[model samples]
Target chain A: MEKYKRNERIGAIIKVLGDNPSKVITYNYFSELFSAAKSSISEDILVVKKTIETLKMGRIETIAGAAGGVRYIPIMDDMERKDFINSLCNKLRDKNRIISGGYIYYTDIIYSPELVDKIGKIIAGKYIFKEIDYVVTMETKGIPIALMTARYLNRPLIIVRRDSKVTDGAIVSINYMSGTSSKISTMSLSKRSISNGSKVIIVDDFMKGGGTALGIIDLLKEFDTKVEGITVLIASKTPEDKLVKDYDPLMVLQHLDAQKEIVDIVPYEHKDYV
Target chain B: MEKYKRNERIGAIIKVLGDNPSKVITYNYFSELFSAAKSSISEDILVVKKTIETLKMGRIETIAGAAGGVRYIPIMDDMERKDFINSLCNKLRDKNRIISGGYIYYTDIIYSPELVDKIGKIIAGKYIFKEIDYVVTMETKGIPIALMTARYLNRPLIIVRRDSKVTDGAIVSINYMSGTSSKISTMSLSKRSISNGSKVIIVDDFMKGGGTALGIIDLLKEFDTKVEGITVLIASKTPEDKLVKDYDPLMVLQHLDAQKEIVDIVPYEHKDYV
Candidate 1:
């Protein structure tokens, strides 16, 4: 076996830790992979930790004990976070995004891997200390953002379907009034999708009256799971009566006159949370 | 601004490249971020690239020209890929995973972020050299895997809906026979979801006769898009008469007897392509 250099080991450690965010990686694992001693690997980890901290890229947390290891926690510094939100709001302000029926075509941003990964890091950073077992979301548009969040948080993603199918086996279904259209609709989840008594973080792309988020909350009741938090990319201003009140919205849709193609968007200010 | 050290700059560069896999980052961007000269940043990148390659973690390709930069390409060596598949097959071998109607309850694996991330890396690694515009998948179970693949490939995800909704606006809908049960089903995609003349890689969680994959192919034709490739997590062996001819499946399901709770699973051997 070839000897490993310090720079090579540090680079590999950062890559492994970054890939598995918020998940502990034991020293033994690294030592074995690098064909090095535990003490040497520890020095390499310390170098990674100090470098990451110095650059404000992220943090490498050390967990002590028999089942302990180092974990990576992704972070977007205050300046970068503000810049990202500002740029996102600027992009959303484009008149070309306005479609019929007061809708904004922001699907491009939602699907963009670069943008969604940053969004996920910022959102997941808010709940880094929470005991979240899973990240849940409604189907279709929210899948990308929610999946990214689940990746950052190191948890599984549970998607609630708009309509149930037999391929899902037995499912628990519920009817809830749509907050945007004021029409009743059904949302379903596979009985085996989520375990009982799990703690979940509900995420969505857009929240208009919070109908879908509310439906997710109601659906989780069937499985005896608890929602630890709710987050959304954008929340409309028209629907003041949001079905779900507690949520960390990144941006707010203040006004959009589809007929005139006028729009007003602003970043959400969460006084209570990061 | 504080003076930046070589180790800190290299670590930051690695993190930035790793976070934006398959996407290029110019030296100018790094220089500006670190307040360092372009030549110094170039040297730093060379060191980082060499270190990563030495460790077999990934690649940092430096594109030369007026319109170029450094890009990261993630790789899972043969040993790691084989171990992932073997362990996955072992997990799938559990008799309790055999649900009613001969369906294997593999949702747990599908929802697992860590497992799905590795699966995405392996799948995306194959197409690292292809000109793929989008990563497409059907609604529901395949979303997580597909989303992770899209993230790794640095491409946007286009989800074909099983049922069209009002929120999607105008849509292109198609009906295809379900491969497993021989039942006709409707699959729709928003007209705005995909652009014309784009190349797409279709992915799915499971395939019983390649019906859903075929449906996606047929549906993408409506938008004048080309099918660059087709990949799936599992393809059942019973349905020998699959709708699609060319595909890159990760695993093959040889047998699934519900009453006997027997399953024969094996990793796919693709001699023609990566």
Candidate 2:
């Protein structure tokens, strides 16, 4: 006997899938929960999928096999994505965001849960099929978005530390030159943070010099981890050429005039980073 | 005409609510989307609330009046909360997690998106009705969970920096001694991060001497913000008398015999910390 009506089961199913995006939900799991046959659960998923698609929320994909299950892939459709990016660009373009040294302050935006959750989902949507093992980022501004991306991708997050700490156990420290400057700085990663030969995508809040991204890429090499892709919430327009050639940025910061109190930032065209 | 059927609307409604916990969504929003009357949306919410309650997933609370709407509150229940805390304690008990300085190496656990998400929800559940304006934490390990807490609470997060940076645009710096040691370290925050006389909760990954939490409390005082409560993922049992008397912890670290390879940790009883 079924414990819940179709609508109740559908509601609960959506809650579970929404709670855990990118993580597969087995039919048997739902079947046991509802005390219904797998066929009934599959039929209910069809309704849920149609409703979500009609609403343009995202996509619900089902895998067919013994290891297969349904997963929620957060693909903000084109119009919605464009609107979101445009709104974000507007938020970043605030005149008050320009600091004295010509640095654009968007620490609050990237630190926002709703905002960063969307940013993470968009980043995760790019590499849904890339078979990523971990979402990698350098501390500390990038941790929130990177963690959100890891959540959407259902992957672990490996945070590279600026300095080696005793709590990290065995650490690997490496020095890399700042892309836009002559100064060199060090970045360290815990040896056990990632499995060797794992695939990782680097994420950050901003890419001015690209020095930090380059440093992270070099540090990841120690673990024999493959750099699948690199992404940033925003990248500077100056230094048109970055130390790293291929990185996807959600927005491009074109101009920041501390004197005029002007800040010009725009959303970048969405492209798969991995 | 209604755009979606009853079950479909219920499914999508749950998805929307689950995606945004503690955020108010008006019936008008759903009515416009589904082209259904407010009465219909109200009835759908009834089903959602019943299903969620029956399954012990959480609660769907409805507010009655202008500027009011329905919101989801994540309540893990006593049994589930116990199970979760117990599982975490078991994970922390691994002897291999001990470092040279007796520092437990649970950074991986705290950095895990899934684990930290649950931890954040559990923490946020405690302060759901506390009228918190913001969630505050000192970077960098506490950020993931803090951001998660802020997400669940629908509030902004204020991250204290170890050192003041030009990007911060008028930073406030303070030196606080380490809880376990007499070593003093400087922590900074942007002057504009919080408004004067705001209410906040301090969150961190670990607390030994409560010096860091105290430092954050003191730092927040600079902004004239109220520290309603403080929470940490783990606290040492040795410091039965911590500098801060009223803070809460998810787990208590009883003892760690590095030489004997034994780790004693346990779940804390649930209590209203605020």
Candidate 3:
């Protein structure tokens, strides 16, 4: 096989490393693939690493030892992150987004690949250092962001269903009261979705009373799994008494009056990151 | 700003172009961002373009005009795509995946980011040249894959819900028969999800008799939209007659016997691609 040029090798490395975020790739693998020497591969990696860092796209962590290699961790610098969240807040603050029944028409943002990818990276960056076996979310709107987060973290995404379906086989269903409506609702998960003692991070598009998150927590308990963290794109400001206490919300819906077509949103102030 | 090295500029260019697939980006933006001349940026892009093409990762198209720039289109060679599908089929062939009601427990694959991303790329590649306004799918199992497809295609994802929620505002609901059970079911979509005369592509995780896809087609009619294409990860072979006539299915599940745990699966032979 012909040896790949420096530019070719660098592009291939970025594609591989970027595709498998947080997963280490040994230099030997690249050297063999490119028919290049280890030192040359190392030089190529340095260029990729520096460029990534300079652009604030992500970080490349190098492990030194017999079983060592480099891994990509997607991240956004504080300025970019703050800018992204502020822009998201501004978009959410649009008066036209106020639909009937006090809800915002933000499905476009939720499902947009570019926006969801950024949100996933931001949320996944927070828990990069933490040990999370899986990223979990309920059915419908949350799946896109959760899937992207799982992709970045190199973990499986487990979605909790609103109702148990025949396709799920044996499922563990739980009844919980909706924090927003105070109405009882049932959530179910297939028995094979998560293993016992697994650690999971829950993500969702919007949070009102944290009832759905609470329901997920209860469902996870049924599997003997633990909820490591809960994150959402937006959480309402009206519900001060949240069922799930520990959580991370990117933006807070300060106020929304459908009748007046007024909406106020602010980025959540993270004590540590801020 | 210090002028970025060729290698550094190449890496950053790949990230930016790769991140926004199919979206044209002007050289002026890159030239200004890197404090370099337009000619220098063009040289940098050439190298990145050749490298990507050599690796068969994707193609970089440079349109020459006032509205023209560079756009990245992700693709996988026939061998890689076949290998991916074969591996997916092998995983699905596992006897343990057989659930009680002749259903396959493959939610893991549906929610898997890596697999789903690849599937999305393959499906999106098929329709890259086609003008599609939105990538549509039903709620639950299909959202993750559909979301990725929408992301790669750079289009909005429209999800049809099993039932209309109050948050959806005004909705258009339609009843359809389940191919497997022959039971009537209702599917709804927000009125604002798709506009009149929009062209949509329907995607799903599994198809029994194409009933769900047909339902989506019927639902799209309410908005005067058209179903340009329908793609699914897997489709059952038992019911040879399908509700939807034209569709692309990755794999044909020939047989699945829960009692014997016997299964027969094969990749769908595309008339053109094959």
Candidate 4:
């Protein structure tokens, strides 16, 4: 095997760590990959750590144990995340985004890969040590952001469906009253999708009534799953009291007047959890 | 101002490149980021390039001119991709994955963030130079893989809804015959989802008769868009002739006997285009 230089090993190590965020990578694996001694690999890791910290890219947590190595913990600087959320809010405030149903047409922003990826990373950064078992979401518009969140968390994604399909095998379904529409809606999850006692974070695109997220929480209960946190891209400002008491939204949709073609969106002033 | 050493610069460069695959990063950007000269950044990129190529990680392309910079292009070695597909097929061959309706339970595998991310990268690798404007998928199961593919391609994602929702604003609905059920199904896309005369690739989790893919193609035509190609995770073997021709699947489901609890799956033998 060709031995890699110090720079080569550092570059490869960063790439691998970034690819598998929140997942520990064994030093033995890196040592083998570079055809170098563990001591040299250790030295390379120090350089990689400095690079990440100096750039404020993210934090690298080193684990000390038989199964320990280092894991990349994605973090958005407080000021940087605020700026990002503010910019995204600005984009959502476009007057043309107003639709007839008092809804903002944000399908373009949430479906955007680059922007969604950043949002996911930001959300994932909030719960780096939450020990989340899975990232869950209701079907349709939420999958993109949910999947991105799961990617950053290095966890599996579980999608709750609107209706159970034969392909889902046996499933758990529940009904909840929508806060916005006041209509009863059913959400389903495959019985085998999540394990009992597993902790998960629920992510979604839009949260009007918080009914969908509550429905998902109820559905997860059937499997004895625990929701670690609830996150959404946008939340309606009206009806301050949501079905779920504790949930975070990236932006607060203060008002959307389709008649006047106006959409007011502001970044959520989240608790200083970070 | 602090300056990044050679290894630190290489590590940071790879991280930036990995984060923005298929997207260019100007030398000036790196120069500013590292507080280093453009010449030093160029040398660091050369080392980064060597590390990636030597490890068969992927290919990096350098563009010249005033807009000159480096771009990371993800590609799976042909053999590595085949091995990954075969291993995924083995996992899918589980006897308990059989449901009563002749449909194999693959929700777990496809919903798996790590596995789905790899599948997306492999699919995106095949069309790196296709200049795809967007990565499209129908609602529900395909969103994870499709989102991952779009992330790697650095493009937007467009999801066709099974039914029009109030939040969709104005939509273009198309009715197409289901390939397996032979029943009429409706799919809708927001009119402003895709630009006119742009090219997109349709990605889905499963393709039984390719009816859904065909429906998406028809829906995109309403926007005067071109369907560059179609890719799926699995395709049924019985209906070898699908509604859409020239599509590719990562795996082929040879047979599924629910009674015997048997599912025979094989990795697709793709053309040696790589």
Candidate 5:
């Protein structure tokens, strides 16, 4: 518990603000929650705010009114969103990067901030109409994108890990086939990570067969929550029926020939961003 | 050209610094490059430096000596790294986000400042060993990651679009089977985008079939450059014949069961980060 005390506190404050975004909390509320003084609570709030602002994740709007406390809203607009995505794309195209079997080695790009930002905005823009509450993606690289999107939308990004970790409490698991892997894989989400009636967006970098995507769709149904939409960075006409056929692709992988040495790619139009 | 004249100027300055980390550039050089005044050049550097610093992308080390100018270096430690990722992760986990199909809708996250910081740090961390002159990724989601990583690494995040846009000049393309689409796809990098002998890293969200990964690798090889490494968030067990075999995974999809009544799931180990 101590390992995550700071994180837990931030989560709690976020939750309180998230629950009633319009309703601000006084220092006294956080003070009582952590058994700390009012000043300490204010300091913690500063940390939270600093973290939010530094990450471009969200904003902690403060009101000095007698009844005002704090409100957190995650939002971003077009120019900033495009700039962030442009940054990530640049990293993935570096010349020094290696490639072997036919993938552009972009493990570094997945962890990069620019990619996370663009992914966040793309997903947020897609679901802006849904009045969404939680953002979800399968773990690892999707985590950053999910987190960034949640920050932009002023919501939360929940990660469905492939397996339960020691840190996650009371894990809920599911079995789903990965169309790309052509194998059944386990996916897990924390019991407390999501709530009922939550609107979610599913995102990933690439989608081939989409068994994992479909599996994720099925998982949300288990939570009694709604899936607002499905989005992928790249999509193609793979041999298998795509699990994410219903979703839109930001970019399309039209054709590629590893043996003959030919590959065709198409970028998503800018119309969506503008 | 006009659309990105200013951006390209800033990008050029970043590239210059990236190529020569130990050297400084006089305001006169930038002024001449942009056909602006010395004061304007200084102002632009200030803006660029501030932007990079705010994102923690990198630092613009200034020298006051008569011959002194500005230089950049890619540097960050574990705590900064951890804090960056945690903030992004927290933002994406907002409860108000809605979920469906197991994906976290995060188009906005890609554009958010929060993600820019986290992703910048993540990619920079991976290239710590490499004398990276640039960060690269394909278009769309990968752009932001490339940009931010470039900022942190004090380099330019060069982009390789699927196809050439009107603004781009001549391009060299490669063909490889896309892991996601399983078809011949075109992969291209602008002739002006990157320089030879640059160190680079590759990144993406998921490694399913890794066809796109391979296509990118092929494109890089066309330039006869060195790829520092590849990193990904999720490495789905798509089959061992992937284009990228030696790489790091933030998380792995360890288990799945498509036929089960209620699926059972588990997440990958946190050892990668630890």
Candidate 6:
């Protein structure tokens, strides 16, 4: 709070919400306490709401009727979450994504949050249903989706390091071939992470050949926990099938031939939420 | 909109906000339009507010009088625009962080949006005063900060790829000696990225030695563009002064001796925004 104004109306609003079991509060009372214009109070609430909710500190509820006001609820549940992962699937399935040879190009989807949120939500919803203990994802592209899902679920996200560090202490490593390279790569997590029998949801941005999916699956097994569910933002349509099965995909890439500049993207069957 | 009923409501809220000159709206009208309960409608509003506003669609406003409601304003001045980057710099300077040897652990900060928002805002603010045409950052840890800053500023974030792929066509590479290792390694990005004279900001998660920062600086200079700003989440207090003088660190590490078991952290002085 050094750079931010401590006595600002927004800070006061957040302070008024200090550790309350109830997430809801009346705007009028908050407005009165701040002694600011209702419009200014409203703006402060808007900023605070965005900051807290995005930071995963419960959610802000704005009631409009006679009893209407604002509420800050510090609750985390498995239901009513879906957006990022689903959109990610839709963008990944875009036929316009031309993959030359065996590799698929996710340039459009990675750069689009609409897609990322869609896929993040779908994967998050599925895991939230299973009482997930933690969210585990690899580095780079997967980090964004993992961060999004963890935020939605209100859980701590732990990254599986590609290279073990001395700071991480003794680590447990898992190696599997990548979907695209067919070359063996490794991922590791701290030995003290997630207790035995804990449920874990594996999420990634995209899974073309399922090599990364299988690698995560391997890591989960090594931890002696439940895989619970595996979610990928996008999967490629392979005539020869993929490396792994029994997982969910947000979207499917039909054709990706970058050479001909043709990419066919199709929507997934996750329209139930609509 | 295929993932949740709330998404439909959120989408409707955005659609209602289409091209509206006013930045504020009444909760009653929005709720009535959806034919949803005022409370439920408020919940929907919060979701849409965070998603859209975070993505830089506009700001949310509230009126306090009996006739007041929420409003969406699409105005962000240079200072206000960089809130994302500026926040990024602030949160990364947490003194609570513990570092062993030269490496600092910011995994917890990266996973938190509140922290990310702060870090994102600070970095964005630095370039807000500059003539930045683009935002650039290295892969892995830096992508999230860069992306958040880019989103808030409504600029595209170009990532430097550590590993080259077939789809990248031609690539330009730069070498840097990592903090963990004194050996030099090459990092590459697509050749057609930043145009000549384009102003850029270089961002990263941690700056143990500034090798990667220097590497990206070299790469941007290769494009004949100027590096408008260099911002990092954490800078190591390695006793040896940094080689790159044209950089700003949100936090500087004072102690990082594994054998000594001590660490200190502090924030950098920044412009006061009231």
iRMSD per prediction, in order:
1.7, 1.0, 1.1, 0.8, 16.4, 10.0
Model 2 per-residue lDDT at A97:
82
RMSD in Å for candidate 4, one decimal? 1.4
| TM per candidate | 0.95, 0.98, 0.97, 0.98, 0.45, 0.67
DockQ of each: 0.60, 0.83, 0.77, 0.87, 0.04, 0.13
Residues B134-210, candidate 1: write the lDDT tens digits.
Answer: 99999788877887888889999888888887667788999999887778999999898898999999988988888
lDDT of 3 by residue, A136-171 (tens): 999888988898889889899999998999888899
Shift in Å, residue A259, candidate 5: 1.3
The positional error of residue B71 in candidate 2, measured at the CA in angstroms, is 1.1
The residue ranges of model 3 lying beyond 4 angstroms of the native Cα positions read none
lDDT of 5 by residue, A50-137 (tens): 6555434445777676676676654444556656555544554453432335544444454444454456566666665467777677
Best by DockQ: 4
Give one digit per residue, the lDDT tens place, for model 4 in A51-128.
Answer: 898888998888888998988888877888999999998888888888777777888888888889899999888787
Query: What are the lDDT figures for the candidates, one per model?
Result: 0.86, 0.88, 0.88, 0.88, 0.59, 0.61
Q: Give every collision pair in model 3.
A: none
Runs of candidate 4 exceeding 4 Å displacement: none
lDDT of 4 at B98: 85
Name the docking class for model 3.
medium
Q: How many residue pairs collide in each prediction? A: 0, 0, 0, 0, 160, 70
Residue B209 lDDT (model 6) = 68
